[model samples]
Target: MSTRKDSLKFTMTSRALKLLGQNLYARPWSAVSELVANGIDAGATTIYVSMTEDPATNTGTLEVLDNGSGMTEEDLEHYVSIGFDKRAVTGTLKSSRAPMGRKGIGKLAALYLSNEYYIHTKTAPKAGKQFDSSWHMQLDFMTDADKEPTLREINATTIPTIHLNEQFNKQDSGTLITIPEIELKGLGTQAFKSLASRLAIHFLKDVLPDLKIYFSHQKINEDPRFKEVEWHPAYGNFLLLSTTKSHTYVQDKIKRKVLIQSASRKDSTTVETSITPTPSFPLNDFENADIANHISTSHNSNTISGAYFPDPLSTQTYPYDLKGWLALHATIKTTLAQDNDSTFTKNQFFSPTQIRLYVRGKLALEDLRPYLNLTEQYANYLEGELQFDLLDEDDLPDIATTSRESFDTEDPRFTTLCILVRDWAQILINERSRIAQREKERLVKITANANNAYAKRLSQSIQKLSESKKRPEEVIQEVHLGLTDNDPLEPDAHTAAKEEYRIFISHSSSNKPIADIIYDMLIELGALPEEIFYSSKDTVSTDKTKQFKMLEKQIRETITDAATKICYITSKGFCSSVYCCFEGGAGWATRAVSDYELITTTYAHKPDWLDAGLQTTSIIDQTGTFTLNRETYMLFTQTINRLVEHLNVGRRIKQEPLINSILEDKIPSDYKLRTRKEKISDYYNPILADMITHAGKSDHSAEV
Candidate 1:
């Protein structure tokens, strides 16, 4: 047998190492988070993330120091190794904090922030030892790039120096990572401020109670925006929606699934496992048990299991342990209105109207307005946060994007959450609409009460006018037929009054003779000329002369205005005139046909297009004469008077009542009128008889 030393070694390409440095972290803040996570994994109770920048040179250095169970020389070797699993060997630290660093790639995160980084660590001393073993190692990407670096080459090349000096006693147990040359030059005071906020939100629960995080020697709580992160209750403002009597929803013990892997002699397989119902216990107990079993099992025959249980306090069923409150702005309108001058206008991300989502106390997503698909009106009235711990469960597949900026929409869990959000948003929208309707009804009732009181006051004024020897018509005008300025009927009464007109007359210029007669009649009946819009009289030309185009425009406006009545004078000329037809059509289009009437004379012939149901009055008989001679004039005057009354004009003239009495006397009590066709037949019968007598005489003379 050949005596040869053969040892297993892991190696990686130089390109792979370079890629790791470049792609391990997306943003400088994410790199910082990785460092913080590492400290948390190390059971750090307090972590300091400090930055020193020289604006003159645009250079900066970042250092993260954690007071935790740090690393030994052997631990330092494992830390530098790529793809090494930290939890597999050490498990959770003594502080019982869950390990945040799993893949051991968090160390490479520092490389993304700088080309060079150094680590100094001192492990906790064993029993009977006065001092701990301190170790320091430096990683230079610049030097590593120059060689064909391998995992073994890189790890073996660096030998951490053991510090035996008194300086080692300064820190009991902790680790410090220093990046002397930050590659990202954009990180300045503002950037660090933003980073501090991000840290406070991401480690919202982790950094509280025992763990304290600081930036540039200032605690996160010192920042005004993040001050709440320190004192913020575990459910901060979440339960306030209920006490405030706002619209809210809370669901817990939602069903969720996680993928489990099992290995058999033939092949390994994966299966979806749901939480099994069990007695209430700490969630960490399940996670720790699963992780411990996973680590100890053989690679070829490993198995994993999951547990599920309903929260006894949960009131609603959901897909995950979701608990939150959605508050409507209407419920807290008074409070929000007070801050309207300051807070309402600003489009900040953390506005109260926004929805925040947290996974295990870490804000996984903020401002979920886009996903909620709420209208601007409804969205502004909503605000709340929901906490779902299943999203942060270690064994569950990562649904969050690489940058952790948002959750992956493609993830089933995230998609389900979005669906729930959409449902809640719809519910809130309907509720808000219902509340608004109630408010509208309340205002209407108040207005109605005021209107009744106003009407009573107006009635007293009208009675006074009647008692003052005013004419009946004058007293009617004082009565005010509809709502007035102080009527308290509608809020827009003045605007509605402005659009009102008395009459819109649709007549042809060829029929102007008759139309003018009617116009004069209306004026005689106490109708104002301004109120009666006969296009020929009302419209003025742009050229200071009456033009048809200008007349058409004026006619359109007059017809569109709110009018008491639209009268169409139907004559032979009226039926043939295109402008007359257009005016009539416009009247019907602008207002209902019931508001208009048709007046026919002997010269008028009903058009085929005219509806038979139209109320029409004939002023002349088929002989082109007044129907009952002088009685026709009285009937026409009364018809015009009735129209004037409908126009709400305040006066009526006493128009010769004796003439109406005489016309009624002339009509025989037992007489019945013949139809138009029968009368025409009777008139032609005598003439036809005479023609027949003359024809017979002429024929006899011809025969002789």
Candidate 2:
């Protein structure tokens, strides 16, 4: 049962072809990146990516145009030949730019993008000629698996298309590839801008200084405009590590053995000898250097913590150069908006936390975090970009896996690089911790001084108000006027009315679920459960007699005490319930002194019987399952921030859990809340502003 020699050859199936491209580039962004790389390899000085979306169909066409040394018909043939090594066949690329393509299979990214696409190209003229010919071709792959061609048939295929010589002058040489009818979403202005940033992070701009990339996206009728993408490395308290510098890790590992040199006469104690301790670039060296420099320079904030020029790492085994810097971000919460800077928005598409590794100026590994054991404290804040060109050295066997997403860990050079990187990362983490401790101490001193000044103003205001001997209303008004204009601690008073505060959560029994959520949220924001007066909480007394007494006592004390913050969760159940009305009326009376907050869960007009103060406060409607869009998220976070400030919870609040608990679908931010002045005037302004002495106001009569 032996097969014929002709039939013994390997066959290429259609499913295999499709799966090859799909597996190689699982993400659309990766396939697009490969296309850009091909353009760069062609010595293109400028690459333009233009995307046009059709909202009705939820699809788009992508066009990548590069002013590169375009391919000739012969070159086009080589491009179609999968796995053909152009470097081996034609020698080094003609341009000075390093070729970013290697396996020659990068062209498959085109197929991965779409089954049928158009390629418009024109070759550069010969030295003596003014112009060269231009060509156009359209390649269509069989989408149906049954119609696939054999390997020999695929090789025998010829290009079929139209000529576009009239579209350009002979001097213009470039390539434009168009991928039509691809599914796309989130191509709006901001998302497109983020795409530009994402593309910039994929390649090193310094290495390809002459290569300019512009990206743009537009709807069908809109005009296309492109914006250049630039890379801005976020470095904070960073150490610039260089392979050229002398350091211990690059030195050969020492093998030591102890040998007995002498024995004591009385106790027979043996004296041992060993090799001198292995040389190292210890953390102490950096600390000492930094201290000496900081002392001489008078604590300059701009100074770099440290810099080390190590001898080429992995020298004893496989010598390789490492060039790049590692830094600790100011905060580990990547989703936080840094002063409205869009760059820090916790980009799922391209996170800035990982160390990107580039080989021969092309991305070999998107992130090195997975390859290294970086479990040290504050390791999540570690970010860097490293270059290890040796990994892609022409002389070495290809160490990159088939997908080119990462390198072979089994390779000795890769393992050595990992060890060196892990050590350096640990160094960065330790150094960050040291700097953070110093910063924390400084902030503590500053906060203490501020708090002392604030407390002094408060004591003076209280004394003056007591001695005035005016009517209660008149004295309260005067104190409010004085503190509102002059108190530096006013903001803190506003943030948390008291260091120790209590919250009275009033809601109808029917709205218990919403009340429970609010209760847990308040607890999460730093309010102790015991200090929060939620009637339904299990800890509260359930006996009818004790419950009335407790509620009556809470209402009586809260009306007169500034330490109690009242939150009224109003709904249909609340408006109709007699007990809810009692709580609301009690909370209303406290408006003159107590800090009261209102939340409405219905769209209907609030009852006119509600206190005017609660009516003026911003209304937060729970129209759905408390989902947060960008705008709603902002509103919710701002609300939580205010609540925390008023309570003076000692811990910083994290919005992640709250934000993650709800759906984050994009929604219009048209839902507006009242301005701070309008919302706070009725309660926060009159009571809080005058409770402390303001620093700069000579006239207490000024309206806050």
Candidate 3:
């Protein structure tokens, strides 16, 4: 075979070059960022970016002026060459700063914002020259298509103009790039803000103290200084995790005997597969002492393991040089706005939850939450920034996408970084969960104690009522009124109860006997009869025509005023009676079943409409008598007690006489009510006897 040497030439159409320039940057902010980055690379102490708009023409001019080492005639020629590798040829800037421009295509970024641009630069004089020389290059994107021009052919037509002395004096050397005829259609006031924010993040870690980027915009008759872009703090008050030493994992030797089986022989073998700790940078020594302690004490082993990032490059090692902070603000305040002396709207930069990644002091990724796979609730409360300079090493493959908005997730470094972030996020989430649970338990304990104390005071008041010489019903009524004055059980409950009655007794007229008994029990337990609205006792009109009206009025008043209702579900005429059904329905419609108690006697059957799981009191036995079982009695008493407690009734008794005594004779004279100390015993004796006699009878008929 014969080999022939041939030379090939690369050519690009003007349209293709224009498209390439347009696609180089996704947003105007990104185009500006490229220029600012170039300024930083040139060791510029101050870079001024200004935009001037002409409203009548609807166009603007964008200018970037940097007081840094400028280009000479040779440099100008190289700058105009497309696809030139500046970093490879020049190594670094004259100031010994690492050059940011690599492919030398950043200059195309200007075409993204404007069609015409001009560059004026002056470099220091050669060895024996008395003054520096200046050069300028003008580029017009609206080139004639008929010319079929190449980048080299176009540069040949516009030779760099040279001057004897430095142009735009006061500085030894500098570059001034002006992009005229800037299309300002999409560039509004917010564009400047977006640009500032993006630039701040781009230089967050690497921006030198002396480097200042002043951004400003000017409109007709407007002050240019009014809306100057200000630097804002991206993250604030976060737990800092700065690295003092870099550590890598290594395999440690450990002696261990293991059983090994071979085709010819079986024997014990020694194997080593353990990790050794490094002395200079301990694998377990977190830069932040607090974080180290937290990880050590954490109960979740998974979280602890996740916080440890192992070296992807090493077979048995963890990478530990990355430095940053992990912060969780259950409540986020805009630190960036405060630092910038500005205000933030809801949908601005720095969301409530964000995991930003920085490389070489520049933000490579804004949000890693999507990659973290953390719970949305917890992720929404997190915000942090991590800097890993190694990711930006020139030798490493470029992981950033063309847009430079984020890194390629397929990259190992990116994947590992996401894993590390997820682990740290998990640790923070677990710690937050622990804190919330502890707070919840503490609050529950406090509430329980308060309820117990409230119940005790109430019980004491009932005991005092039993000691008073006044009738049991009268003392009960007073206590009920006092308790209903204001509910002390819960602050919000108290506010809600203020306009409602304490209790509403819903029962059939045929079941008045049981209702009377329950009424007396409630009174004894410190409930007011007035607060206990029963249609039979509450309605007062006697005339036949007015009787229905009065009953209707009482039902409406009771239903409207009631906070809790007690339904006596008896089988006799309870469910069949329209009035009783209405009352029960009204109560049910107004409040939840939890606010009412269902007391069913022996004759009562559970309704199909009623929930089977509702809190119910079944006191009546098969004999139609209230159950004498100690547990049953306690259950009944406890139900009433709960009602009393919820109503916030007074814990003290007041002895007073009834205004009218016409029904004094109706009260049982043989009711052997004793002093407060013996009231429980005396009250139960007669009640027990009546229940026993009722049980002993063969008759199934009962009035209750």
Whose TM-score is greatest here? 2
Off by over 4 Å in 1: 1-18, 21-26, 87-94, 128-143, 146-170, 183-190, 206-208, 217-320, 323-356, 360-363, 366-385, 392-412, 420-704
The models' CA-based lDDT, in order, is 0.50, 0.55, 0.52
Q: Which stretches of candidate 2 lie over 4 Å from their true place?
A: 1-3, 90-92, 127-171, 185-191, 234-319, 332-337, 340-345, 439-466, 470-704
Clashes of each: 4, 17, 8
lDDT per residue for candidate 3 within 1-704, as digits (tens), equals 88876977767555655676788776677788788776676667777777777788888777787777877656666776786766666443555555555567777787677655666566655675523343333334466532333332232124221221123456667776667777778567776566666665566543355667777677755645523345433223222122112211101111122111111111111121122121122324442222332121223322222222233343442233354555554333343323322332224433435667766555566777888778645566666656665455565566666556677776555555555566666666666566456545644553454445445544666686655565655544433333243433434654212223356677777666556555656665456676677666645666756865666786666554433455555555667777767676665554334345666654255555565556665556665665344444444455555556544422211112212111111222234333223333233435433433343343325534
**Residue range 1-704, candidate 1, lDDT tens digits:** 99886887657655566577667655677778778878877778777776656565666666677887887656666776776765567543435755555455767777677655666666776785533333333344556644555322233124321221123236688877666656545554556656666666556453245777766623222322212223222221121122111112122211122111111111111122121111222334324334322111112211111223223244332234445545444322333332222222212222445676766555566667787556646566566556656555565555665445477665545544554455555555665565456545644553454355336635665666644555655443333323222222335544212113357777766555456655666665456676677866644545534465766776655544333466777776677777777777665554234335566653246655555666566654454432223334444444555566545421111111111111112332222324322332232223222332232232111111
Give a tens-digit lDDT track for model 2, residues 198-223. Answer: 67877786588788888878886676
Estimate the TM-score of every prediction: 0.43, 0.54, 0.50
Could you tell me which residue pairs clash in candidate 1? Answer: 275-307, 275-308, 276-307, 276-308
**Candidate 3 root-mean-square deviation in Å:** 22.0
RMSD values for the candidates in order, in angstroms, are: 27.3, 19.9, 22.0
